[model samples]
Target: MMRLWSIKRVLLAALMLALVQSAGAAKPAAAETLTIGLIPELNVFKQMERFRPLGAYLSRETGVEIRFTILSRYGNLVESFQRDGMDGAFFGSFTGALAIEQLGVVPLARPVNLDGESTYHGVIYARKDSGIRDFADMRDKKFAFVEKATTAGYVYPLAYLRENGVESLDNHFAEYFFAGSHDATIYAVLDGKADLGASKNSVFDWVRAADPRVDAEIEVLALSGNVPSNGLCVRPDLDPGIRERLKQVLLRLHESAEGRKVLERFNALRFIETSVADYAPVYAWAERAGIDLKHYDYENR
Candidate 1:
């Protein structure tokens, strides 16, 4: 009887152990997908082509699928990050500030361009012969800006205009159109569709090389003070381990020949570590301009 009782108890204990092990295993692990959201700041297809290789490299390095999602506008990208749909993103300064304040997304790194600087300028541009000699000359002239969400494309230019006593587009220009991106704004000016345009100075420099018509058509009238460049960021809920790993990988990209080639496609010289604190200037600018640096609740939309 004792021997039979021992066998029964041992079997029962074994079953209990199995049940405990299964319960522990059933708990979900950290997220498997790392979704990267980007603004369609250029031709959508070209943006995808520029980033696909980097995404693949990241996936191969981390053993996690890196998915790239392009939102129609920067605002929508901010909304998605707030809702936790995106694990990370590459965002302009304005949108990145919104994500940091509203979604708790943290800035991880920024790309350094060939100039060895991580800051870009906001430039006011016009045709050399348009008689718009300076920003003040923009009065009664047609203008183009990227979407309102863009920093150099809209915010900085607007702020600069307002500070110089130009309050509204109506008060300062004969007409204004949103070209939707730095490239498009430049294009609009080159095509003679607008008398003045605003764009990222670095973008202007790079694009001018590809299409010298930009130089032949438009001249920079003014430039905003240096502004921090765009950056890679991650949602607040991201696993710290994964985030750290990503940061390490990014920082070393320019160290390898293959990595440098990938970054070169974006006109990036290298990746440098960054943090939410580094973008405080951008937040200050938005705040002074009375722009809400928070993502609108879009559950219904």
Candidate 2:
């Protein structure tokens, strides 16, 4: 009886040890990092610096590690999303629409401006002394556009030019180039590198505020019809719970002091929930402009 009892005690101890080992092996590991991509609307350094606080806020809110990435070109942002390289993105209206149609990205939220408006216009501008008074005067002048994928910077201006009988940029302009960013486009024109340039109105306004001389030096030649605001989007396949939480955090950003600071730094009044249909105007513009949705290549430019 004593021998049998000793064997039973040893077996019980071994069983408990096995259960402990199993629990240790099953313990959860740290959360995986999520990467969010941004279009090159501004200088890369400024983009990262301005967005880092927002990324950190998201990380803390979702209990998931977050990293921000800025693509060198707008098309690269779309390519990255197609490749599943980005978990989420802050996409311009044109690129956002393309991503939605191509990759099924989910529109999450968009920023509201201080005027309580969620829409912005595209503008063509030139040096005040350039003598280019209107869109018709832009013909045969050196031109600079931000990027082909940019709605305010490229598409709107291109459509306006086409409609006004300035059909071919390559044929009409003495020289032209993609300045790669809104600031670059403005500086190109101000420095006399280009006679005319195009960019989003809000961005131009921000630049004017930063350097009052820009207002004195530059004049708006024409403005495009209203365009949808940029939007935050996520991969359709992103974890549903995480996606919902991220949307909630952005929508509620104005409700917190720290969040408000972040929003202010981004030059936004607040973030509001957005839907896929909000970008329909962009699609319509593209269709009317005869822009090839699937075959357009940003690399060859």
Per TM-score, the best of the predicted structures is 2
Candidate 2 local distance difference test against the native: 0.86
* Candidate 1 Cα misplacement greater than 4 A, ranges: 1-31, 295-301
Look at candidate 2 and give me any clashing residue pairs. Answer: none
Per-residue lDDT of 138-236 in model 2, one digit per residue for the tens? 778898999999988888888888778876778888999999989889989888899899999888887888987788898887887776688889999
Query: What TM-score, computed on C-alpha atoms, does each candidate reach?
Result: 0.85, 0.89
| Model 2 lDDT, residue 257, Cα | 95
